[model samples]
Structures are given as C-alpha cells and as structure tokens.
Target chain A: MKGNEAIAEAAINAGCLYYFGYPITPQTEISEYMAKRMPKVGGLCLQAESEIAAVNMLLGASASGTRAMTSSSSPGISLKSEGISYLVGSDLPAVVVNVQRGGPGLGGIQPSQADYYQATKAYGHGDMHLIVLAPSTVQEMATLTGEAFDLADIYRTPVIILADGAIGQMMEPVDFSERKPRELPEKTWATCGHRGARKHNIVNSLLMEPEELERSIRDRFERYRKIEENEVMCEKYMTDDADIVVVAFGIAARIAKTAAQIARSRGVKAGVLRPITLWPFPNKEISALADTAKAFLSVELSMGQMVTDVKLACECRRPVDFFGRTGGVIPAPADVAEKLCAMSRELSI
Target chain B: MVGSSKRIIIVAGHFGTGKTNVSVSLALASASRGSVIIDLDTVNPYFRAADSVPELRAAGVRTIIPEYSNTNVDIPTLPPEIASVFFSDETAIFDVGGDDGAAALGVYERDISRVGYEMLYVINMYRLLIADPEDAVAVMREIEGYSRLRFTGIVNNSNLGAETTRETVAASVSYAECVSKLTGLPVVFTSVIGDARAPEGVENVFVMDDHTKKLF
Candidate 1:
C-alpha cells in the first residue's frame, strides 16, 4: 500500500466513518482512497471547498461523536490551523494527518519535516498540545493511524499523524488484517440528540469567563500530563551499548536506521533512537541514554527543528549535534553514516 | 523480451503497480538497441521516472520528463521534445501515469496511432483495490477510456515489495491469468525483483531493480 492510502484504509478499519479533506500533493491519495472506499463501506468522504472548510467539517463530525479525520500537506495544514484550534478548544477527538511537504508557504511538493515545530508546538492558537504520532514506514502508517484515532478518543484531543511526502508517496506491502479491535470509551458527552433522558449536551469551545476558560484549559492539561507520562513511545535500536545515538523520527528515522547499520559495519558504536510520539518527545528515553552515550545526533529533513527538543530532553548532559537537509532535500544514508563515524572519532570512543 | 518487435511501447496501470519500474527495466534492457523513455506521468509528483533520469542516462537511455518535474511548480506541461520520439527510429517507451495519469497520454493518441504503438497494462494482484480480476479489468477499462488506447498485452507485476519470493510470484500467476482471460490480452511477462526466476508456468520473466525506491 502507498502510505497515504494505508492511513485512509486503516482509519476505516479503526471505525472512522467520516473523512473530510481537500486535495493536496503528497497527501492527496488519502482523499482519493477515501473517496473510492468510503462509499462502499457505508461512510462519508467529503472533499470540501478548501482545507479550512474540510477541517471545520471534521470538527462537526467529531463533535457528534463520530470517528472522523482530515488530511493535507504543509500549506493546506496551515489553512486548517484555525479549525484545528477550535477542535482542541472544544476538546474534540479527531485525527489530522499531515503528510508533510516543504515549508513556510507552498514550499514544494517533495518530502520534508519542516513542520515539526508547527505540529508539536503550535498546531493552533491556545494552551493546547496534540498527540503527534510519527510513522516511519507504510506498515506503521497503517498501525499508527489506527492508534491515532484511539489516542484521540481516549484523551478527547486532536491527534496528528505526522508523515512526510516520502512515506506518503512510497509503496510497500502492508497487512491490514492483523488489526485488533480497540476498547474505546462511550461518548456520553457527545452532542448527539438525547431522548428526553438527561440534560442536553452542548458542544462549544466559547467559554466567556476567564476563570472558567482557565479551568477548562487546566483540566485538559491534566489529561496531557497523563498522556505524557504513559504515552512516550520510542524505539531504541542497538542503543544498549552505543556511544553515539542518533535521534530521529518519521522518514528521517528510517534513513538513520540504515546509517546506524553502516556505521556499525565500520566498527563505530552508532545506534538509533526513534520517537514514535513526536509530541511527548521521548525525553525520558533520551535522558536515560544520556547517562551512558557519549553524544547525540539529531537527524531531520528540516534545518533542525527536533534538535532543540533533543537537547532539552538530554538536559545538556551530553553534547547534541544536528544534521539535516531542508527544502525537501532528503539526506543520504552514506552522508549520515559519515557524520556518525566522525562523531565517534571526535569522542574517541 | 516482451514487445521487443514494437517501435513504441507504452506502459500503463493502476497506481503503485510497478509501471515506472517496468518501464525503466525495459528501457535499460533495450538500451543496446537505442531507446528513449518518455516519462508522461503528470499525476504523481513523487516517484516518477524523472527521479531515475540519472540512472537511465547513465545506462545510455534518453529520458524526457515533464517541463516542471522535480521543481516546486506542479504543472503537468509536456515538453515539445516528446514529438521527437514519433520522428526518430529509436525504440520509444512511454512510462505513462497510472489510472487517470493516462489522460496525459491521450493528448498524443492520434500521433501514437499514426506511429503504430503497443500499450502494455501492468497489474499487481497484491494491490488492495485491484486485487480481484474483475477490479483489475475495471481499472484496465478506465485506463483505456482515458487514453483511448487498446492494451496489446498484460504484464503481471504482482509482488509484495521487499518481501516477494518465488512462491509469491507463483501464487499470482493464477490471478494474472484471470486478468488476461478477462481482457483477452496475453500475459506478456511476469516481473520479479533481483535475479529471482519467474514462476514455473510464467513465461518471459523480467528481472527488475526497484529504481523508484526512495532512500528517505
């Protein structure tokens, strides 16, 4: 399956019936796949007039306690930010997929990880954080998309599937049959009509009073704290006895994995630490590795957005380095391997 | 070995069905005969034959890509150099876009017909949407509707990427035969990765290297 199509199919398998999206390069396959499959599965796939309208439609679907999602690339994601903020303000559960392309404003159609800051730190306006899941392969694109919906419903917050154009466009073999059914909580707070049984449920984010708004924000953060403590997922490959650990996520991590293998073949103690959840940032795992590892290298498709988070995660206990290629240029594995070997030599370890 | 007698060979299929890989391999295999591969894929921005221009040129196969390919501009404008394929005697292979991408090929339907071209539809039974023979036939008809070109043969390119085995190729032979039977097109060849031989009953095996596999 192509990574974008895998996400769409996995969303359906995870009980996501409503998909609202606008077409954008690198991620357009998600909408295309949904348009073809949704009707057959007795669901709704609406291509809105714009990215903003698509996200607002997702907001409406999610408010009624329906499993819904919306996908776009970087510039389109920017247009959906306002709607995303509203979804968060209403404490809605929905999945937003950003098959990231290049940059600040309609940068390029090629793959990029420049939206790390946008996805993790400031997806929208307000005191809010999204559960960001970064998938490295086409298979994970399926599995993590299923997990993204579950995480959103569990926390009642928007979850971001932070993919890049490479994964989104690449084709691979994926098995969707192994998906286990999830135990999701009932949406008692949903604004779906009640049969004169209880009080009417209102779905609105407009809290007029400052104190009430602060309380609402604080309550959401408490849930975020629980997620942070329990949801920090990272994969440590060959890090058990390594001096230089490379930290990366999404497509960058897959490249780093190959680089680590090459560095190991050349007798360098290189390993990879892949963060699956970009928002939680995998701080504890990196800090744990800092106790033994000599240094850390953050490899990204961006100029170095995740480098800051890696540095802060390690608390400067070890030296952190950055290697990247911006503007949709993917770093080669050999180049990353060379960096790993050089870092090992510099540390004399 | 398939369509070697033809001057113009056009490869079309559903998305992710190994059309570009087949086109590249066919062009490289026929490089000694002097070939030019035209990347007429305007539908997809990534993983196009344009990405393999360096490799294709290195192997002595001339490559013609969209005017704005590999650039920030995502327009689907074909270059005027494409007309040279019709005039030259060199064997031209058009790696057309999958499904609706064939609409780009429709623009040159009259010229291609004038030159007498052979269109080969690539199929992968492992692809979810086109797993069934009926679904494969439906997509085949859709491509035909868009390009206004009749398929001369079928290329069973079914395999799980990076996980394909001899058994996998063998398992897909029945599916390919079903497609061939339904479309009244012969199964020209079966594509296998690396040096793996084609399944027992499959004829004219084409060994392909995944030139479209992105490093990152």
Candidate 2:
C-alpha cells in the first residue's frame, strides 16, 4: 500500500475508531483509505468540510474518549492550527498525521521537511510542543502511527506523526505484527456523558485566571518533562568510535543511512543518528555522541530547520554543518555522501 | 521481447497505480536487443517515468522525455522527438499519464491505432476511485475514451503499497476477475511487489520491485 494508506490501516489496527480528514495531496490516500475501510470495520470515517472542521471533529471525538485522528499536508495543517491548540489546551488525546509537503504557504505537493519547526517547536500558538514521531519508511509509518495513538492517550495530549511526502507516497514492506498494548488508562476526565454521581467533565481551554492558567501551564510542562525523560526515541547506526555523525529524521535519515554505508566503504568513519521522536529531539543522545564525534552533519529536505535543533541538542559542543535541498527536492544518497566527505576533509578527520 | 510483435505498449491507468514503476520494469525486462521508453505523462511531475532516466539509461534503455520534466517547472511541452518512439525499430513502451494525462497521448492516438499497439490498463483495486470493480472498469473506459485507444488487457496491479501481502495480492484476483468480466478483457497478469506469491490459478504474474521508491 501507499504510505498514506498504510497509516490508515495501522490506525485501524491501533483501535483508532474515528477518522476526520480533508483531502490534500500526498496525504489524501490516508483519508481515502479511511473512507473506504472505516465503515467496514464499524468505525466512523468522515470527510470534514475543511481542515479546521476535520481537526475540530477529531477534538470532539477525543473529548468523547474515543481514539480519533486527523491527517493533512502542510497548508491544510496550518489551517488546523487553531483547533490543535484548543485540543491540546483541553488536554485531548488525538493523533494528527502531517504528511509534509513543501511550504511556507500553498507550496507544491512534493516531499519536504520544512515543517520540522512547525511540527516540533510550534504546532500551535502557545508554549507547547507536540509529541512528534517521524517515520523514515512505510513500515515505520504504520508502526509510528499506531504508537502515536498510544502515546497521545498516555500523555493526554495531541501526538503528531511528522512524515514527509516521500515516506507518505513511497512503498516498502510493512508488517503490523507489533501492537501497542490496549490496556490504557480510563479517560476519567473525558467529557463523555458524566453520570449524576460526578460533576460534568468540562473539556474547555479557558482557565481565565492568571494564577490558574500559570499552574495549568506548569502541570502541562511537567507532563512534557516526564515524556521527555521516558519517550525520547531514536536510532543510531555506526556511531560508536566514529569521527563524524549525520543527524537526520524521516526520509532524510534514510538517505543519510545510505550515505553512511558508502562513506564507511570508502574508509570515512561516518555514522547516522535518526530521531524517531522529533519533539524530544534526542538531545542527550546527540549530546553524548558529541563527546566522541569530531563534527556533525545535519541533512534535511528543507533549508536547515532541524539543524538548529541538532545544534541545540549537542549544546553547540561540536562543528555542525548543514546540507539540505529545499522546495521539495530530496537530496540524493551520493550527493549526501559527497557532502559528508567534504566535511570530513575540512575537519581533517 | 515479451511483446515483441507489438511495437508500442501504452501503460495507462488512474494515478498511483505503479504505472511508472511498471513502465521502468517493462523497459528493463524487455531490453534484450534495445528498448525505448517514451514518457508521455504530464499529469504528475513528481513520480514520472522520466525520473528513472539515469537508471534506465545505465541499463541500455533509451528514455525520451519531454522538454522540461523532473524540474521545478511543470510545463506540458511535448517535444517533436516523442515521435521517435513510433519511428524507431526499437521495442517501445509508452508510460501514458493518468486521468487527463491520457489526452496528452491523443496526439499520437491516430498514429498509434493505425500502427497497432497494446494498451494495458493498470488497476489497483485498493485506490480510492477504483476500489469497486465496476469503478475500475469505468476508469479504464474513461482513459480509453480520452486516449482514443482501446485497452487490450487489464493489469491487476492492486496493492496497498508496502503493506501488501500475498493475501493482499490474492484478494485482488476476484476484483480483477470482476473487472475482466465487465470489460470483456483478459487479466494479462497480476503485478506483485517483490516475491509475494501470486494468487492460485493465476500463473501469469509480473514481479515488481520498489524501483520507483525514492528512498529505502
């Protein structure tokens, strides 16, 4: 299946019973898949009028304590930002799949990672970060999508599956053999018809009072801190005893992995650090690698969105060079390898 | 030389049916003497057949693409060189574009019908519009009407991309049978990714690799 369709199937397998989405390129297959399969599976799949409506529908479903999701490309995601913020503020658990395309606005529907900042640092208007998972392959698109639901429910927050157009459009073998345990905590705070025994579970974002909102912000940050401690996921290849490391995520990491292999064959000690979870950003792991590696190369499909995160992760302790192809252009493996070679030569490693 | 006698093979279908991948594989598979791949697709600029020009060129397959393909600019300018696919003696494969893209092949329609050609309609029963067998037949008919060429056969390339299993391939067999019955055309072969086993009694199968996948 296409990466987009695989995500929908994985969502179904993960017990996500509700899907509300609008049509957008690259990620349209996800909504299309849901529209076809959800009804047969006894689930509700709705093609909302707009991206905002779709995200708001997801928020409503989440408030009702149902596993729900919404997917869109870059521009459409931007339209859902207000709803996402409201959902997060109301402490709703939902999954938002952003099959990223080129953009600052209305950008072309080709693969791009420019939304890294939007996905990780600022998904909405507030001092909040989404639990962002970037899938490098179609299999991961399934696995991470399933995992995103579990993480969202566990953290009681919106989790974002930050996949680019390449991973969402490309095909590879995927097995949904691994399933997240469904023994999740009951939604005690869910607004789903609270009986006469208890007060109505008000799912609202308005804390009006300054002190109250401050305390709520602290509580949310505390949860984020706990998630940071427990849920930072990443993959490291040939990083041990390597002089140079490549920091990437999603499709960029796939190419970087190939570049690392080619560099190793040519006797360049290169490694790759692919951050599976983009929000936690694998700060400590890359920081630890900085102790041994002489230099780092941040390769991305955008103009160095994640490189800033990489530098911050490593605390600026090492020389970090940026290699990127923007406006939906994917960097070739050979080109990435050549850039790494040039970096190695510059550092005399 | 799978279809050696047929000079031109027009691979057409709805979008994302692995037509480009099939075209590339066909060119590579039938390149015993030499093969020419003409990229007549202008609908989707992202995953066009021309993107594999370097790979096909390396494998001794000549690819004739439009003037501005695989570039940031998506202009549907057809160069005169496209006629070479018809003129040359080399076995030619035409990766026809999807939906409205079939109209792009209308220029060569009269020539192609006159010279004789095999038009294969690739169908992925999993895709949105073509999920129903009736819808699949309708899509093929729509393309045939737009391209002014009749479909000689149906290529059951139903897949769920990477999540495709032997079951996924087999499930499409019944769908393909229905489509074949409706269209009065034979199911030429079922295209499976990698070595996923073909359905029972469907001996003719096309094993497709993920050559069109941009990354691993």
Candidate 3:
C-alpha cells in the first residue's frame, strides 16, 4: 500500500477518533483513506476548508481528550503553524503529519526534505520543540504513526511525523495487523464535562500574565529536556569500526544506507546514522561516533538543512561535509557514494 | 491483439486505480516493439508516469515526461516533444490523470480521434466512488465527457493491496461484467498481482509482478 494510506490505517488502529485535514499533494492519500474508513469505524473525518481550519479542528478535538490528527505537505503545513503553536501552548496532545514536498512558497509537488529547519527549529513562532518522528520506510511510516500518538500523549506535546513524498507515495509491503495499542495516561485535565465537583476546565492558551507564562514555558522546556534525554530514537548501520559516517533521515537515509554499503564494498569503511527523532536530534550518537570516525557527511534532499544540525551535534570536532539536491530533486545513491569516496580521499590527504 | 494493433493506447481511470502502474506495465510489455510512454498526468505529482522513468528506461521503454515534472516548478507545461509520439510508428502509451486529468487529454482530442486511440479505463472495484458498477459507469461517462474520448475496454484491477487474494480477483468478475454491460465495452483484462489464480471464468487476465516497484 501507499505510505500515506498505511499511516491513516495505522492511526485508526491506534484509536484515533478524529481526523481533520485539508488536501495537499503527497499527503492527500492520508486524508482520502481516513475519509473512507473513519466513518466506518465510528470516527469523524472532516476535510476542512483550509489547512488553518484543519489544524484548529485538531486543536479543538485534542482539547476534549480525543485522539486527533491533521496532515499536509510543506506549503499547507506552513499555514497550519498557528494552530500548532496554540496546541503547544495549551499542552494539547495531537499528531500532525507533514508529508513534505518542495518549497519556500508554492513549490513543486515532489519529495523533499527542505522543511527540516522549519519542522525542528520553528514549526511556529515560539520557543518550543515538537516530537519530530522521521520514518524512512512505509512500514516505519505506519509503526511511527502509532508511536507518534503515544509520544504525543506521553509528553503532552504535539508530535510531527516528518515524511517526504517518496515515503508517502511509495508502495511497500506493510502489515497493519502487527500494530499493538499503546497504553495511554488518563486525561484528567481534559476539558470534558466537569461533573459539578470541580471547576470547569479552561482549555485556552491565553495566559496574559508575564511571570505565569514564563514559568509555564520553563516547565514545558523542562519536559522537552527530559524528552531529549529519554526519547531520542535512531538507527546505526556499520558505525563500529568506520572512518566515515553519513547522517540522514527519512528518504535520504534510505539512499544513504545504500551509499554507505557501496562505499564499504569499495574498500572504504563507511557508516550510516539515521535519525528517527529529528528534534531530539540524535546528538549523542553522532557525538560518540565523531570520536572514532574521521569525518561525517550529511546527505539530504534539501540544500544542506540537516547538515547544520550535524555540525552542531559533532561539535565541529570532525569535518562534516554535505551532499544534497534541493527543490524536489532526490540525491542518487551513486552520487552520494561518489561524494563519500571524495570525503575519504580528503581524509587521507 | 488488443493493445498490439492500436498505435496509441491511453490509460485513464479514477485516482489511485493503478493507471500509472498499468501504463508502465503496458510499455514494458511492449518494450520489444519499442514502446514510448508519455507522462500526460498532471493531477498529482507523487504517483505519475515520470516517477518511474529510470526503471522504464532500464526496461528499454522510452519515457517522455511533462515539463518540470520532478522539478521544483508547479508549471504543468506540456513540452513540444509530445507531438513526436503521434508521428512515430512505435507503440505509444499515454498514462493520463483521473477524471480531472481528462481535461489535459482534451488538448490532443483531435489528434487522438484522427489516429483512433484506445482508452482503457482501469478500475479497482474496491476503490471509492466507483465501487458500484452503476457509479463506475457514471464516472466513465464523466471522464468521456471531459476527455472527449470513449473507453474502448476495462481493466478490472480489483485489489486490496497486499491482502488481495484469488477470491478477491474472482469476485470482481461480476462487477467487471456489470461495468462492461453498462458502458458497452469489453473487459480487456483484470490484473492479478502475483502467481495467484486468475478469475474463475474470466479471460485475458494480465499477470503483473510489479518488478518496477522498488524500496528506494
């Protein structure tokens, strides 16, 4: 099945009760799947008028303690940022999927990782970080979608599943039956009806006090720090005795894995570090590998967005080079292998 | 004999009915005859004829994509190279978009009718909007009205993805018959994924392993 459709099914299997979305390329299949199945499962799937309205609907649903989600591509996701920030401030747990396509504006409808900075650094105008889960495979797209919901509830923060168009549109064998329902914490603070024993729960993000807002923001940051320490997810391929490491995520990681294998076969000891969580950033793994690896190469579909993060993660101790294709162009495995071979030459020199 | 005699074969259907897959399959099937596939699809960029150019080219089938197909430009410009497909004697396959994509095909309506093209409306009975035969006929009429071409045949690609079985394909025979009856078209073939059993009483089944599909 297509990755977007698999994600929608997995979301339904994970007990998502509401799905509000606006149609956008690469991610429309998710909404289409949800529209067909959500009603059959006694859930609500509404295609909002726009991305802004979709995310706000997700906000309303999440505030009432319902598992809700919204999906869009790069341009649409930008429109939904205000609702995302509001959800973060209100501490509402919801899943927002960004099946990324190219862009600064209304860019082309092709797979791209150009939104890494926008997604990890500033999804909205705020001092906040979302739990960004990047999946490379269609199977991971389904499993991580389920995981996105669990993490969103556990951390009480908005979780973003950052998938590119390649992973969103590709067909692969996915077993939706293998999904296990995650145990969730009770939503005692939810704005469900107040049974007359407690004060009516106000699920608004409008705290007008300076000190109170500062304290609350600090408290949220503390949770973010804990999440960074405990919830960083990544995968390593042949990094143990390597002279070179290639850092990537999502579709680029899939290509980089092949490139690393090709480099290894060609007698260069290369490895791959795939960051599953982008906001938590997989810094410790890269830092530890930087000690042994002679250099690091960051491969992406964007013009060196994640490479900046790789540099910071390695603390500039190791030389970090970048190879990328921007504006909907995907980097080829052979091209990445060529870049890695050049990096090896530079290391020996 | 169905697609062999026809010089220009146009594949169209609702979105997600596997028209691109069928187009690629047809081009590769006729690769020895030097087939050329055009990416006439402008509806969605994710799943289209141009995305599989590398694989199609490797199979010895030439692919002509629209201008800025995979590039970072939203301009759905049809390059002048499209006229080459009409003039060439080699087999041509046009992987068109859904009902909305028919409007793009409207541009070539005069040439298509003059040369007499075959429009294969691929159908998956499990897909939405066209799950019922009456609804399927209605959609075909809508597509015909939009594209200004009548469907020559139907490809009943009734699949539920990985869960598709012999029974699934077998069960869609009546649905295919219903659609054929309403549209006054013949069932060209129903596509089966693997070496699974073909429909019990149906003929002309197209067996596709989908080898062009890859992980990366």
Residues A1-349, model 1: lDDT tens digits: 8999999999999989999989989899999899989999999999999999999999999999999999999999999999999999999999999999988787888899999999999999989999999999999999999999999999999999999999998888898876675678999999888888999888899999999999999999999999999898889999999889999999999999999999999999899999999998899899999999999999999999999999999999999999999898899999999999988888787
| Candidate 1 residue runs with Cα over 4 Å from true position | B1-3
Model 2, DockQ value? 0.30
Q: Candidate 2, residues A127-188: lDDT per residue as tens digits? A: 68789999988889998988999899988999999998888877665678865565578889
> Going through the candidates in order, what fraction of the true interface contacts does each contain?
0.76, 0.29, 0.41
lDDT per model vs. reference = 0.92, 0.86, 0.87
TM-scores computed on chain B for all candidates: 0.96, 0.94, 0.93
Q: Rank the candidates by lDDT, best first.
A: 1, 3, 2
For model 2 the TM-score comes to 0.82
Query: Quick one: best DockQ, which candidate?
Result: 1
Candidate 3 docking DockQ: 0.33
lDDT, candidate 3, A2-57, per-residue tens? 78887898899888999998898878889878887898899999999999999999
- Model 2 in CAPRI terms: which quality? acceptable
Give the lDDT of residue B117 in candidate 1: 83
iRMS of every model, one decimal?
A: 1.3, 3.7, 3.8
CA RMSD of all predictions = 1.4, 4.6, 4.4
Could you tell me every candidate's TM-score relative to the true structure? 0.98, 0.82, 0.83
Give the poorly placed runs of model 2, Cα more than 4 Å off. A194-197, B4-8, B13-17, B25-44, B54-69, B72-117, B123-151, B156-184, B189-216
Q: Residue A28 lDDT in model 1?
A: 90
